[model samples]
Target chain A: MKYHILIAFFLLLTNLNKGFAGGGEGHGQAFDPAGTAIHHISDGNVYTILDGIGVTLPLPVIVYVPEKGWDMFSSGHFHPGHHEDGHHAYNGFVLHHGSIYRVTDPTFPAEGSVEVQGFEHELENNGGKDKDVYYVNFNGTKYRLDARSTLDGGVLGGGITSFYDFSITKNVVSMILVSLFLLWLFISAANAYKKNPNKAPKGIQNVIEPMVLFIRDEVAVPFIGKKYPIFLPFLLSVFFFILGLNLWGQIPFLGSVNVTGSLSVTMVLAVLVFIIVNVNGNKHYWGHIFWMPGVPGPIKILLAFVEVMGLFIKPLTLMLRLAGNISAGHIAILSFIGLIFIFGKSGESLGGSVVGSVVSVPLTMFMMAIEVIVAFVQAFVFTILTASFIGAATEEHHHDHEHEHGHGHA
Target chain B: MTGTLAALGAGLAVIGAGLGIGMVGGKAMEAIARQPEASGDIRSGMIIMAAFIEGAALIAILLSILMA
Candidate 1:
């Protein structure tokens, strides 16, 4: 059974290699490891499962133009070609690298599908800063493409643009899929417990019960005290939600969706935790933040400022830690695989390719092993920090005298 | 020039984080050795401290990337 499983694992690895190879089908252009790594980590509208097999799952594209009104269509209308570049544009919106961009020039058709010649990216100086400007070619004329509007107000080089993309992206799909899977697993396990109340845990129950108990015993109870039961559900949801997404991204042939690696997703999760913790904050938490009971008047003001900053920084760190770690892991794995193309001189040398594969396969495997551990560690860390924050916020004031005495002794 | 500096900054941040996490792990090991029964608590505490240090380093790295 072990041998069979190992053989299946090798087969999956080979399939992964084929998928990557298909995406990197640049004829003579130099292999761009950094760009490739970034592209792989970025969320996409079209989900390409096995690029070698040309199997892409289309997602719905919903965009809103300020004056042009709402336009909805399947991303398949883009006829995504190599590198997820669209062969055709639907209603003036072209898909480039799996992202939809609108052609601003009036010369391009506004209502119907049109065949696009190609896409071009140029570095243009915008207000003393160099920025990538994308253009789509149609009827031999290159029209500048406006990216989807971002709420960053151009601070991140994305501002109020021609359109707003409210599409079901790859990350969104992955989150839905993972959530549904978790729901099924948990519901079935719950049923098992209900049906066999006297018997020992089995199958999925065995897998989940230990983790639930660990969090309840080690994290929730110790940190949150008697109020653990109230927050246990939220903590479990956060832990399992993150763990499921992290593991989902680790799968070899499942589009390698980097759901947890995305900053926006992590930001939302952090925002949820922030809201929950603040809303649940007792009088002691608010008092400590606004005016500490024991500190000097001058120091109380200084400390309040620091404490308020700490409140924001806690959630900010939570967001960055999860996204940074997951993204770094994905980038490391991709860079290792890029070693093959680097050594092969973009497939010009057979011996170089062989050596590169020999070196990178083991390295990639080791990195994947580390990533599995990271998947658990990061989820655990996020949960523990969240619990600690909650514990601090909801802590009773009965121990105030004890804490003061301890500080006096120190 | 900016790219080079960004790389240097990121490397420096990693170095600091490496040293910090190394110390946390080392001390945790010593604590575990002294009290084998409390290893679980020690290990978890070590991880939390290491994560805090890593968070600071990650912020630095992110700033460097944005600057680049």
Candidate 2:
């Protein structure tokens, strides 16, 4: 009875807070939904936990300049927002758009200098109030910085950066975390199996052993046949790694990094698969691609061109498919959330915002639920396609009828 | 104006994918119903085909976004 009352009281408190939030009238500018969505989905140097609260965790920026050797510092030096306290430049380097660049102009702010917020007036070409500006020189070009980003108003006419950035941005950090977790999960499962070789699995072993068997039996054996063992490890790792990152992205508070949505990450994953497929291909595969034994000369040439083109196209499609699916899901959810603010602007009243939220909140939740299923389905599809590719490459052609033909001829 | 056109393109892509995946699912169900013992094999094959259809749609949508 005490627990029930406590739960009821908490629910009422939340409802009251929601009411108050919706009760406010038209006083502030509508939040830019597209900008917020893009910021959330894109790779960033700082992990933003809550945009309204201005809570963010800055990552480390690592860059190498041929002339400067090495410059390493926390991304905090970039000063995430005006409210946040930090230096804008470190060792003549500045962070812009998740990258680091070197400043060359002597008039530019030096290391540990306070950030000037806004576009510089002198650099402004248009006839208007001069905007406050920070200048950064990259290579032989000059660039200006405003509060939000490096704007194009310098000698080069666009923002330029010369440093080789090796920063551990938000996505990189999340990848490391997911990798460590996977290592721990699998290693512990392996240890458990080792300790009890003859017994049935328990705990994490029981949970993981079934998944491992599913990949072996459903994906590997049927697809790769005798060479199943050779590719099982890669297939399992890809499936779980994707699934882990996808599920992690669903976490609301972690400011979850969209690893799979990033094109470069997907590209690397696809390229690795491409390498494995080609390296493991057999004589039959190469023969089928380059020279058709039975086809006419003209047709064979056309087929060979198509076959070679297919190799590159396959990996490119894989990269785009995964990135597109993941990013689309993120955008859909964010757009739904943005509807409330949009309605607030249109109606010019709090009631419209409340109605929009009421309608959109549940729909966003529904989309999120679908995303959870997509996460699993995409991982399964990637693994199965990879296995099938390997299977095609390594399959051996049999000529049993030819042996019988020799007997008949004799 | 370009954004609106891009959204229309995405919608058309989704419609095509919806039709293609629906056909795949229907065929898979029919096959499974015919041979219940081979349901697993049929389901996995259906998923691969559905994925291909989705890949086509996703590529179209991505192109529209990029163009916009």
What TM-score does chain B alone reach in each candidate, compared with the true chain B?
A: 0.98, 0.96
**What TM-score does each prediction get for chain A alone?**
0.92, 0.79
Tens digit of lDDT per residue, candidate 2, span A1-410? 99687556433323332311221111243455664566568787777664435576888877766656776788776775522223365666565433444665566655564453322113353333233345544343455643322233332123334445677888898899999999999999999989999998899998798889999999999988998988999999999999999998888657757899888799889999999999988887887788855669999898888888787877777888888888879989878866766665533556666666677678888999999999988888889988888888888678564422110000
Instruction: State how far residue A32 of model 1 sits from its true place (Å).
Output: 0.6
Task: Give per-residue CA lDDT, model 1, range A309-352, as digits (tens).
Answer: 88888888899999999999999998998887777766666567
DockQ score for model 2, please?
A: 0.51
Question: What are the RMSD figures for all models against the true structure?
Answer: 3.4, 7.6
Q: Which candidate has the top score in TM-score?
A: 1
lDDT of model 2 at position A76: 76
The residue pairs found clashing in candidate 1 are none
Off by over 4 Å in 2: A1-29, A82-106, A118-161, A346-350, A400-410, B1-8
Q: What's the CA error at residue A171 for candidate 2, in Å?
A: 0.8
